[model samples]
Target chain A: MVFTTTKFELLTNKVAASFGLPDARIVTVDHPLGGTDRATIERWADAAVDTVVALLTSG
Target chain B: MADKGELLEIVDASPEAVMDYFDDRGWGDGLPLVPPTVERVEAMLAACGGADPDEVLSVLPPRFGECTRRMVAINAVLAGCRPDVMPVLVTAARALGHPELNLRGVNATTHPVAPLLIVHGDIATSAGYNSGLGAFGPGNRANATTGRAVRFLLLHVAGARPGPGDASTQGQPAKYSYCVAENTAASPWESYPRSVGVDAPSAITLHCGENPHNFHDMEADHPGPILEKAASVMATLGVNNAPIGQGEYFVGLGPEHAATIASHNWTRRDVQSYLYERARLPAGLYRKQFGSLAWFPWMHEVPDDHLMPATGHPDHFKIFVVGGAGKHSCVVPSWGMTKSVTLAVAP
Candidate 1:
């Protein structure tokens, strides 16, 4: 699964398409991952985990 | 006779129409280009010292185009370069291909850094590179076109076109063409190439860098105070150096500034060491600026209470005296994780 920020959504999508990966295999976090506290990072990680799990588990 | 690449019949009524054809095809840097006629390309190829035109110089990314001498000559001709400047362009290309320079990340990343082409030694003067007043600006053909040729190679050959391959959010003016020669005659120390232990009479150093941030100090006559002012600018929290903490930083000192420091009996090594010791951000301040998530594993190696140096070491501060005459100096920060590479210009 791929993870990126909102600002990078266009770039991420383009890169994903280049590698022949559809939108289902990609995930995106917030605009910036810097300057955030550990709890905020954990929250982003938590938000991404379900999508990551589902992508990995799917046939 | 046409070269190996596919020949295109551009049936234009006038020269302007032919230029428009190339522009319409998105092959230009938005500047007027010298028509790369077959003869002009062959003239450029002649300057290559018998190296096979079809010989692969390097494979540039993200498209991983195999750049050959002929391809480079074609771009050089289009960038309006004199045939003599072909060797310098070739050497600069080789430097870009160096593995440690990390051309892959530099070409593809969202960073606003452009490869700064720094020429040193006799070839700098021979090629008419502007190392004096307005060195980084327009007015010199060699400085301008040699750099533009590299950009063209990156765009047409390497496929580092913006939006798709090159993800620069807001690229600087330097992206169009960024090339400068060291004012070796005015400098207190030897040329950068010789100082770095390379015996070549000419060399090119490629650093993935941002636009110059001018550091002014009209008051300081002594080197110590001048360096203190420079250290302040170097330690700015927002720059890539402070946050990333793992690349070289360049300080281009004007002639007057270099003379002032030289009078104090300070060598280039002294200047580098002084800046390294002072240009640091405290660990607490680092965390405040970038937060804990931004910390690299290397940051943990430093004591939590200590101030982390802007670069890996004192040597990472690449200090070179340039510019004709001024009290002003400039600080150039680098793209993180990419090291500057220098290669001797082939005859």
Candidate 2:
């Protein structure tokens, strides 16, 4: 699974496609990872974890 | 002999027209370029001493274009490099091609870093590369053109064009043309290439680095105080080395500073060890700067108050004496994952 920022979506999608990974395996957060407070980071982490769990369990 | 590649004719145009043609096609680096006429390209190839023009040097990434000797010569001619500098450009390209250097990641990342070409040995003097006053600045043909050729290769051959591939948010000026030779004659220790086990007349080491940050210490006559000055710069939280935790860092010591440090009975190893010990950030400070997400699992579990070394090991701190007639030194921060690669220049 890959986790990247929305700004890097174009690049991340290109890489994922190159590696032949399905869309379900890729997760994107917001762009500009800088200036983000700890609370925001934790929230993103929680959301990412849930996404990974859902992706794995749905299979 | 020029390899059989596609050719174009300007149809009796003026020099400005030729420049316009290249600029229109996005072939020039936003600077005036010497037109790569067939004669000039063949002259560069001839300087390669009968090496096969078709010899594939490396496959550059993002676009994954295969760079051949003939292609390099064409870029060299376009960059206005003299024939003698071709070998240095070739060696530098080969060093970047090394997997350990991770050129692909370097080109793709948003990090403000570029490959710095550091030349060591007698060829530096023979090629008239500036290792003295204003060495890192302009006015020297060898230093300027050799670096420009590599930049063009990255753009045209490697496909690291800005925006699409090179995602540098605010790229430093060094990305324009960053190349310097070691002032070996004035150094208090062995030349950098020799220290790294290459005994060639000239060798090029490609380092993925940022612009040099000046570390001034004119008042410090003692090595201890001089090193303290360096440690302060190295441990700055703004640099990638601080939060990332493991990367090779370079300290370019001026001649006077190197002599002062040598007077204190310190070998290069001693200096590296000293810097490694002092160039550290407290875990608390790291946490304050980066918060809890900054902690990498591989980092040794240390308390918040514990001091963490900037690099993984002492040897990761590469110290070389360069510059001319000053107490001013510089700390070149790395791109964080790439290791420097040194290769001998082909005769």
DockQ of each: 0.32, 0.23
Across B205-324, the per-residue lDDT of candidate 1 in tens digits comes to: 898988998987787779988898888988877777677756788899988888999999999999999998998778777776664323457876776579877776788898887787
Question: What TM-score fits each model?
Answer: 0.89, 0.88
| Tens digit of per-residue lDDT, candidate 2, span B267-309 | 9999999998998888777877775333346554778888877
| Residue B162 in model 2: lDDT | 75
Model 2 chain B weakest 10-residue run by lDDT: B291-300
What is the TM-score of chain A, computed separately for every candidate? 0.78, 0.72
How well does candidate 1 score on lDDT at residue B165? 67
Give candidate 1's error at residue A14 in angstroms.
Answer: 6.3
Go through the candidates in order and give each one's C-alpha lDDT: 0.82, 0.83
lDDT score, candidate 1, position B208: 92
